[model samples]
Target: MTARFHTLGLGAFGLGALALSACASQGGEAPRMAQADEGEIVLMIGLDGLRADFIDLYDAPNLQALAARGVRAEAMIPVMPSVTFVNFYSLATGLYPESHGLVTNAPYDREFDTVFENGVSTQEERWWGGEPIWITAERQGVRSGVMFWVGSETQIDGQHASDWSVYEHEKPYDERVETVLSWFDRPASEQPRFAAVYFDRVDTVAHREGPEHPLVAEAVADVDARVGALVAGLEARGLLERTNIIVVSDHGMTEIDPDNAIALDTIIDFDTVFVPEMEGRGGAGHRPFAMVYGEPDAIDAAYAALDGAHEHMRVWRRGETPEDYHFNHETRGPDLFVLADTGWSLTAPSLWSRGYPPYPGVHGYDNHHPDMAATFVAAGPMFENGVTVPAFENVNVHAVIACGLGIEPAETEADPATVERLTGGRCPAP
Candidate 1:
């Protein structure tokens, strides 16, 4: 029977038609789609700003059940300066922030000497340049699906996923789960070989009320219900055994003390700095931190002032950045990167001058902080059941997914140890 594809919109854009055409032109011998022999379907659900400890605070039947049955990591180390856009790209491209070129939510473009706000509209060119796993899967005729991933809205390699949804504001969790189940309902020949679903409300609300807030717990439970629905859908359709399910998050969040705010105007002149967008509440990237842009001489002066003025902060030039951060070297980030010490945050005068209200929660800190450590859980044939692997880079997820679908990874930055474990230590380096 010929395969059929469909999309169920939840007040957002769909990519079914675009993906189908893109998949057809990428000509290569189609890899064998995983059949029931695969023993499980691969479902990767991303919960934004989900700290690993949030799991213990909330009663997540679905996630807890997965952990009880399969393996759960003690903590998943995110890429350096663990912001959402950077880590998400890391997850997709399996490359460090520097290698992938998306170093921060608002990166400085050295050539333009300006700040580029890494938003949904600008992600196509400003935020991402490396080959993501979905693009690689499509090249091999392995159908893939995406729902609100960081770079999903953008086209890659002249193609996008065979199924996808644009990033949008929070929607009902049940609707999100239903959309994912619908993709799997398609005939086996047409169903996505790999799929990603994103749940942002947890992160959104958590950022406002802190990870321990009642609202945050409520949001997690809501997400759990959605996971239960998706899992049930897979079982009812007999796709459970043939699918692999992965649950993860970007970075965690921490509460910000208004008293601890570091006014940038206090350290540098406002006119000399260029902030792309700073008044749109959460839309603007500055929070828990700030990016300073200036001429080389001016940058040097500002760096010096910040060094003595703010003892709680650390600053570095883009090229001299720490190897652990792995930031893009090519002039994409600011001339200098500033990280506020814990309990302290950098705030812009524009926020107050423009009459925008303040936010209560923020991320964009060193990935090593416990608050920045995300979570990862996988259950399927590609992963060893009830096995907990050591902490590794989130970038390895892309290679693991590619191996599961039997496709060539687009890059080789994935850790050899992680790759071997994901492929059952059988698939050789590509």
Candidate 2:
């Protein structure tokens, strides 16, 4: 509604974005625990690195069935530099990366000197500048659960969710689904009215095997099966009719050829700027993008040095970045953004002097690139049946979930009209 998407592409989305799949079924004011007798529930399931087109390409009947009955975005547009931590937080807070202060993963926050890493950075609430749904839900007198959603492990607003789980990357999919479903088995008062679970195997495996590899397909099926399990478990508990399911992937996957590596050492003036985390993974330079930090004079010189150094990589200065990017935070945003072209790696040659172990998959490209588009689907009493809504930004997800929970969303940049349509006007625009 408020400038929904600057660039709408039929590229990776193909004809599916245009087709209409209509279903006729109606229900009450959806997902509002404030009113329902059985206490309607809302489940937010996050699947990492699942391309918007993967469901159609691979065998994912369970997700397809849900979409056949509910709302599916043509593709979910992630905020700029479309990486994991940034977009997931954007989805949770309804803010761009700049507004949320998580411009990129593992940056040197000038004020705090903290690099946003999974283990070290997640504990500090200062790194995150917005209110996540669980915290907002709790404040509004509703119980919420989080099974390892980003920022869930930390005390966002002075407390954890009513129920929460620590992250275990190798945890089995069925176990995670069971963990989410198990929350419902609690007594009516103890159960979470809203909940979230994250799965990363697809993104992990794809990073190694690329999007087309059979292993990625296997991962997709594994996630699809978990969706089936969650649905069945809810039905067995007679909560299926009351639960609204919203599924999303942080960002899509794109394959990077080993030869596509763009060595920053060749272009960047090392004295002028340095990457914050140069010790981990042997300093691979954060793959596909790097946030460079330096003094003003140094940043100016470094920007001049790297300008037009390569055709494959693009350099965006703090103030001169594209409007759609919404980049440029004082502390979290870098002096310069060195973004590799889609399917290329932004790395320093020194780290891989030994050998380049191929990582066929990567993201964090330009947000509007079709390959970077993520997936979105919602099926429940609160959503319209059988529809493919126009593509919208993931930021709107925060408000939509808040609306389903019947709570006022925190201050965010989500377009009210976008959230209204996605939630079938359960929380309409003022």
Candidate 3:
């Protein structure tokens, strides 16, 4: 087999130049696996938007086996604005969105004058903050294969991962599994000590059909099959015994009533606010919470209009969001925040002159909501077998992974006791 590498950037792909540089090993060839001293491999498998209860609600033998053999957290508490990119970054860096600088899936950074849309600003390394797990492993002289982690595409601090794939959600799940396996099947010294893989169809299905739909049961089975394949492959390569396999989702899903939409224009007079960035009518990515930006006086007017006008949603000025959310970023934050209750969505009434939006499910509600809780399943030597732990914050995961790799995790916003609980006291660090 040949070393393969391809990077999709700006024009056709939303990836950027730094991403191309990230795969510089692609001089018509892919980045070859690098040397690492540790035999403890960490394989992070991400099943996006898999609700905590869905594990038992759906038939998932593979996930059940993993839990039977490893630690299964009661639930994984997500950060404020419990959305994909925010909690994913929090899981990767052991920091809250405020510390990681990606307060939202798509944040507007005033300092760089850049807006962080998925395909647009994702490749801009300047927008990323703190040390992601891949960068952490790389800094410690270990190779990392980031098949498709959320924050893995940039050239941070002048360095990139040992190997990676450009973001492609439509890519088949089998292909994703095969690519990650290729990294592990290598000679022991050349294997990456850390790797991450993602599957989006579960989350996608829930978006279109809602989390309770029977189709989601099928999606659950499909991911279970992927897990089965991963386990089989690792065992075939004789790497399973030494590998630390962890399964986690950034956030979970909640059923949203399509008719239960809170029209932004009706709640807050759109005329008082500017267009474009100002109006995010409770869509999926911008939902349970949507940011509002406008001139100071105009924002004041908008907030007053929204204060008691709606029953299903709550609104707050940017800096004044509930202390629990840690959402107050001076520059990247919007002028005001509007959060919808679970099972409800925010929509742009002006844009909806035609009809209501077609989303049947949504996330991004308060992280404490049971529907917002994610998944955390692990099996390996790094954890005690057949045990269950109470729910903990996602911020503590970075330290746990670092502990498994036997490396010192960088200091961040995580509390030591919280991280210790995630590890079951197996690996301790300050």
Candidate 4:
């Protein structure tokens, strides 16, 4: 396997220098598709913000049953900048955020000199770089479908799923399942071999009510019920035997005290460094984490200005970042990353002026943090029954699904053993 990460000046830069070269390769020999007898349809469902322990915390009989029947990982670790878009794209492409280019939910891309926001940015295809599994499936002569996934709505590598829809959140969960069921109703030749569905209610509610809030439990139940409905619908159509149900989450949420906000003004002087004001948009990155893109020459001064500025926030220079997080994107990312301590947040002065309260729950913390671990479970024909795997990165999810579909995975940072364990050595050629 080719080395995907290139670390430069590790010892010379110490813990503060940025150590990234460029995005990883976008090509590799596609995996050999599985034979008809070995091929298994995969349906990956992303339950946003569902923690690894939420299944046990809430009364989710359907999820518990799914875990009992098939394999459930103790936890699924999210990639760095443990936010929605980064990890979701990671799960889709089997690449880290550095490789996929959806580094954060909102990020400033210097290449295009554009700030990628939620709605306006998603439509731009250049923002998405990696080859998602949908495209990989198409390459191997297999059909794929997606309902409201990160990259599914836009074309990646000049192609997207054979069947897909623009993301619609207001639609009820059951209606979405019915839409998926409609796809299954197609003749065997036209049915999708691999599909994906995304559910955000749990994450939405959790962010408002906190993960431990009663509303979060209710949201978990609602999603579990939705999962049950999907399974039941498949069973009614006699598709359960052939389809593998892979349930996962983008990233877990953590409760934050509204009063524990760290104002950026208190940390660094805006006059000394380049304040991250992009086209009148002043806020840096999302809360719980903030990225500061400053004058290249003033980086040391900027680093010194914010270093130990707040006890709750840690400042990382370009090369000083942890190699494990893979967030050293000097070109695409900020020069300095100010990560709020878990359970805390970094806010802008404008928020206080406008009286915007801190969010009850948030993510985007270091992926290794305990509170950021997401869930993973697999059941049906392809996965081993009643087996449990150790914690693995969400990037491996695409590989697991690719293995089930019997197609070569695109270039990924996931471990090969994860795909092996998830498929129980049933996966075909790599």
Candidate 5:
């Protein structure tokens, strides 16, 4: 079937025209294979904070091989703010941050009038509201598995992935890969129809050391080797061809010079901004850019003050955020959100005292920045071969995966064109 593009409320440049050309060039039929079945296993490997340019810089033989074998997108544009929790939820729910409600790494719940930070354990109720892919799969009687997704610990719609693990930010990369292989070894009866694995070392290392740093390059090469190993293992067991493999990332990284640190004292009142309990020790959210939680009136005044005083920063109100943001109201976000200028970063006072200089790479910039574009690649029986499509919004991932699984998408905000591309234009409405 020929893929049709439907333009949503978001402005359209040439995306629709490009999509149409993509379909027409393929003779109105998405690639197909003999193993195309409903219950085939789907594997998604998330390499956190992997930028599109990394592909050009690094020697990723395995990733390059995957692209050579199957479909690859030039880049994948993450949702607004482009933070971890926000984009991860966007991938799982196929909804923008606004619809999924996870606006930042640390969000404030306006409903309960409370704030949550990185350290807070996300309960089933607090972390997730909309149904994720795993939950929807389980409801359809198809088992699913997750290792360290944003809200894997949470139970959605009274259902969760059959096998799951808690979110641990500091876990070793090798251990995470091993766990996923072990899950694949389980008996077919208990095996998951869908599985997701996350790796943080690349992003973590990049944040501390610049993306060009040898440590960061070493981490990226390590992830690429791990990908090769995982694919080889599946091939050895005759599962590689049967299982669809999707590799993606939350967002990309950019260099930050220490000389560019924006002093918090220069922008807003340090005394009025209440430091919540869940913030990290020396993280960006803790020092120069505190997630302010307080009365709405006070928050509004603070936003206005910062807007006028700081030329490099911008403050967004709870509900007045741009429609493209997809943040789920202020429920899990701060009363006010602040973003620093391109080269500027937030730092704690103690870090300077201890002689610890800030790192040179970061990723929490606005989504429009080209450096923030993440990577997306897919290889399996169901995907078209050697195809490189133009960049699209990251929220469309949820719907694309759902289509591959022959399941209904849990969220409706995904672009229809993505659904058509993934399902061979066979998706039904949510």
Candidate 6:
């Protein structure tokens, strides 16, 4: 079946066109997978917007089998904003969004005087910072391949993944799987030790059909089928036993009531304040949180307009954001943050004028909310079988993958305890 995809900047197939162009400009050739001294392979699969509990909610026998045979986390806590690009980079770098500098999927950088929007803008490497695990592995002479993982397109720190696909939604899932298998077929000296594959249909279905809709269950099953195929292929190649397969998602989805959306214009007089780099309304990416930019006085008014407008939403200055979020870093943070309560979203007045239909589901709520938790399951030589580990932050995943692939983990914010829990006390660093 052909997967229908939305055009959201964060998880949409619309960016695939731009990604194709970028790849063509970069010579349109796959990078040579450099072999690592250790033959151990690590495959990191990201199922975007996978709810933490959905694995059990749906008939995903493959995922169930994975959990039964390998270490599975009770929950995977995502970073603040609980958005796509934010947590994807966080997971890749083992750092919070504030540290990595890709705070939002569509962050506006004041220094560069640009916005890192969902599509073409992400192609700019300047928008990315912090060393991703693939870059770390590449630096250590290990080949890494990324199948459309966030931030894989750009030339970060003057390097790209050894092998990667330009984003293209038209590419069938089976084709993606075949491409991954082909990577392993390379000579040992050119085999990638660390590889990542991403799937967006589950998240897409969640956004259009709500997380609780029956369609989501079907989507989960489809993804599970893909996972099963991947495992089967690895086993066929005699690589399953040696490969560390870590399946994860950046964040989860929540149902959004169409009538519960708060319009920004009704709350704040746009004439009084300038809100730039704002998404939602009719925009592709809509969620529970929005980034508002304006002068200091204007920011105060924007905050006041929505402070009591909705019981489910809250507004704050970027610095005033909760410390637990770790979002108060020095780059492109919004002057004002407006966060909708769970299952709520902030929209534009124009949307109301146009009779805009609310998204069936959305995310970007407080990371601490259970609704925002993602998925984490690992099965491979590096993991202890049948172990259910306690929840850990997504930032610690990079270190775990690095350890599995025998690459030295870069200095990161991952707590020692978090690593120990995931690695069964076999963490490489103290």
Q: What are the per-residue Cα lDDT tens digits for candidate 5 across 72-91?
A: 87889998777788788778
Top lDDT: which candidate number? 2
- After superposition on all C-alphas, the RMSD of every candidate to the true structure, in Å, is 9.0, 8.0, 9.4, 9.9, 8.5, 9.6
lDDT of 1 by residue, 216-261 (tens): 9998888877778887777766567667788888887877777776
Better of 2 and 5 by TM-score: 2
Q: Please, what's the RMSD in Å of model 3?
A: 9.4
Q: Model 3, range 1-430, lDDT digits (tens) per residue?
A: 1111111111211111111112112223433432232356688999999988788999899999999999998999999888888888888887777677888887876676656767756777877888898898788776899877888887789877899877997798888889987876555556687888888878989988899899999999999899889988777665677678999998888987677777776666676664333333333222466777778899888888878777988888876777767756656777888888898777665654345456777888988999999999999977889889988888878877877776666666666665566566654433
Task: Provide TM-scores for the models.
Answer: 0.85, 0.89, 0.87, 0.88, 0.83, 0.88
Quantify all predictions' global Cα lDDT against the true fold: 0.69, 0.78, 0.75, 0.76, 0.68, 0.76
Report the lDDT tens digits of candidate 2 across residue range 78-157.
Answer: 99878888888888878887777878766568887756677867887878777888887788767899988888888986
Candidate 2 lDDT score relative to the true structure: 0.78
Per-residue lDDT over 1-430 for candidate 6, one digit per residue giving the tens place of the 0 to 100 score: 1111111111111111111011111123343332232366799988988899999888989988988889998889999889888899889988887777877777777787666666686678878877899998888777799998888988887799999767897688888988998887756656677899999888999988889899999999989999999998777665687788999999988887777867776778666654552433236234577777777788787887777787878988778888767765565777788888898777775534344466788888999788888999998877888999877889888878877765567767777667766776565333
Determine the C-alpha RMSD for candidate 5 after optimal superposition of all C-alphas: 8.5
Error of 1 at 130 (Å): 1.1
Model 1 bad stretches (over 4 Å): 1-40, 112-127, 275-286, 422-430
Better of 2 and 3 by lDDT: 2
